[model samples]
Target: MNAKILETENVTVSFEKLSRRASELKNCFYCGASLPAISGEHIFNSSWGGSYKDKNLICCQCNFSFSNSTDKAFIIYVQAVMNSWVFKGQRHQEVPKIVLENEYFLDQGAKLKLKQPLIEDEILPDESIKSRLTFNSKSEAKRWIEGDGMATWLGRLPLAEEQEKLKKIIIETQLDRTDAKPQPISYQLNLREQYRSTAHTILKCLGFFLPEWVQGDLTKPIREFARYDKGDWRTFAIETKELFPVAEEATRILGLGVHHNSVEVYWNSSTKIVVGVLTILNRLKRSVVIAQDYSGLDSILYVVEGTHGSKKPPISVFTEFAQKQFSLPLLSVQYFSSPNNIYQYFHDELQVLMGIYYPIDAMTARLIQKIEKNNKKNLKLDQVSLEEYLNLFLSFFLDLAKVASTSVDMTKARSKLIEYGFANLAHQHVGKLYTDPDVESLMTLAFERTVKDFHAEVLNAG
Candidate 1:
């Protein structure tokens, strides 16, 4: 029998650590044999009624094929992952759960389908939480192109080895990684296709877990999944099928080749274009960076057009901010050369930024020097004394400043600032509506005073 493709919708999962006292807790919950992570048993069994809720943990070697012949519990388990569930109490405290689903087609060559849902919504800020999804195929041809047939990837964790490997594959695929290009990914797809014959083998698997902060809101929620890609920083795109909306997004990520952890791919409904980021963090060991971006849509810095010169932010301005505010130290708040300098900055001093994020390190100091150099070029001013450079840099060039290449109405600017995380520091200040535009002067003063205050806060926080 060929494995069928199955979709898991807004599946909710969690994990718990079992004490590793072999002599104390080695018995399987089902039969009391030695435990290895857990004993394997079908999530659903007809004899136990139709629900995954009644799963009985059995030892891995002891699960003697409780075939579909007698259990309906696995059937219920499959359905729950796709549908939102409302549970009470410390839900994660319950035993780790698994959602079992498989395409049971009789034809050996028949293709099976599987999909994992994500989220999206209109009117919310760009970085707001929205559901998303993915549709994968298990047939040879499609699997060759798509990578992995009825085989699936787990995003969240606390699973046994095999499940962890799948999770790592997904993470590697999603981040901006070294093998971010198409060739590596295509090669991997070919490899997974070679295993199409085993796609429906019904191996044991584990469900995913949510981050500590987010409670279980499978419907409209936020989550943290383990992810990474080799940072050799490569990126790619995919076309979207008409079935889902928000399929066209401008975001970019790294593709860390075949085996590294990668996150689920993104779909954009707006333009029918999808972009995925990948990176090979360590080419030496061939490791990848996963869960690299948490600011959501911050992956794409979208500044309203024509706002920068007007003292408002240009789209390019926001991209830099996205990189700074969300990217980890190695990736964010760095002084990458001149042209790139324009990508990220805050309205406050780097020292202030250092405070919010922690203290400034030597790398950041070099970055500050880089930004000052770049800013000098932008102003078209002649070479000045080091003191002048220091004053200008100290006054306006914030390590995490909101750089505007244009001007906008106070309301819109404030909204954009807050949405982009500047809310952590800066506030919107309204100017006299009828006065001649003195936006730069206004910005300079606001930036200076605000930066001073920010530095003080950082000192206090520290």
Candidate 2:
């Protein structure tokens, strides 16, 4: 079965409807203050390529404060991810260069100074280096170099007399090989600040998405967090988990488009709280769940898995009378392909709840079978293959629907699939083989037919 493509028009309509509802409110949703003036607020920071905005939600003062503080933090966090392979594929923004390290290294038997910045290819894992470098600014780098430190076993600086000899050797070495391409230097990443900033940004965005009537309930704590008024901001529990090996390996071969960063927020009726989760490339996951009384001063923070996993703690929600008044679905753990497929379940559920159609396991399985049969290959579909195929099929559908674009080279796309372990399938037989106008037409027809058939089957079964 074909996955439904989320059109840009549909998204615009949804936001417009929400904005209209928000405009009718008398007070700012965030500050609970009488709105002297209201401004459009992007739920996701505008700096990060997000265009969706809600006019009439935030007061002018709150909007300015958030844009400078919370939004700035969010931009820093996204900038770090911009250097990552996964996020780079999905976003088209000018990425700022990040200083990775400052260190003394050996070049031609002489100690040389090097300051490493993040390079695109460094996202892959390597075990050759033992220690990482950290320098926040130019002054920091200068201070470390000026300070008297013991030389390591790698090498020590030359004495005053030896310096002249070493300088000659370094010049001779450079003169000999001027044609070699420079290799990217590797360094360890310290993302503590970026992570903190991202977490705060996610919480603030969640506030904007909550129903306007319920938003006032969140005003106090959110404002405090945004303003950094509370010193114990770390009280909010946050954790990051590595993606499964297969998914990770596939990402390296295919680059970041295999998965993208996403934010999901849901009202937990049982707990009488709101939960928001931010998943980075579906690899690193972080969540914040907050509960506040009517006064908002008496709020409690709980550490819960924003997504599902066998190792992750079960999500908690309290079933109280007032909480049940909302018609929203109570956040529940719905197992998808496997226990490891945790956070994606809730993400997909949010899409469904928002009237967006996503491909189910059955649909994905059927698509895989069709592809295998068409290619006359007896390929075995594993968890990783399933994910890879699902992404590819979804992207193909979106491209057909004119909602998004895909790489034009069918051969390259097919090679990525094979590299990710779909070995048995014939590349020529997959998805019309060539990306010609006629091929696109055939794909569109095939996709529409499959989706129609799947809907019919579901209706008949019901």
TM-scores vs. true structure, each candidate: 0.15, 0.39
lDDT of 2 at 452: 51
> Candidate 2, residue 240: CA error in Å?
9.9
lDDT of 1: 0.25
Q: Rate the local accuracy (lDDT) of all candidates.
A: 0.25, 0.38
Clash count, one per candidate: 101, 6
RMSD of each: 29.2, 17.6
Give the per-residue lDDT digits (tens) of candidate 2, residues 1-462. Answer: 112222342121111111123445566655667653556655444445344455555567766765544455444234333332212221344333433234422122111224432122223366454433333334443344434321222258535454454334334542221111112233222223333445444543443333442354454564455444443444443332222222334344534331333454444444455544555433344455443332211111111221111222112221122221233333433212343353455344343421121112213333444555543442443444444554556544333233112223444433444443334333333443433344334444444554453334321221
Using TM-score as the measure, the top candidate is 2
Sliding window of 10 residues with minimal summed lDDT for model 2: 10-19
Best by lDDT: 2
Off by over 4 Å in 1: 1-265, 270-275, 278-462
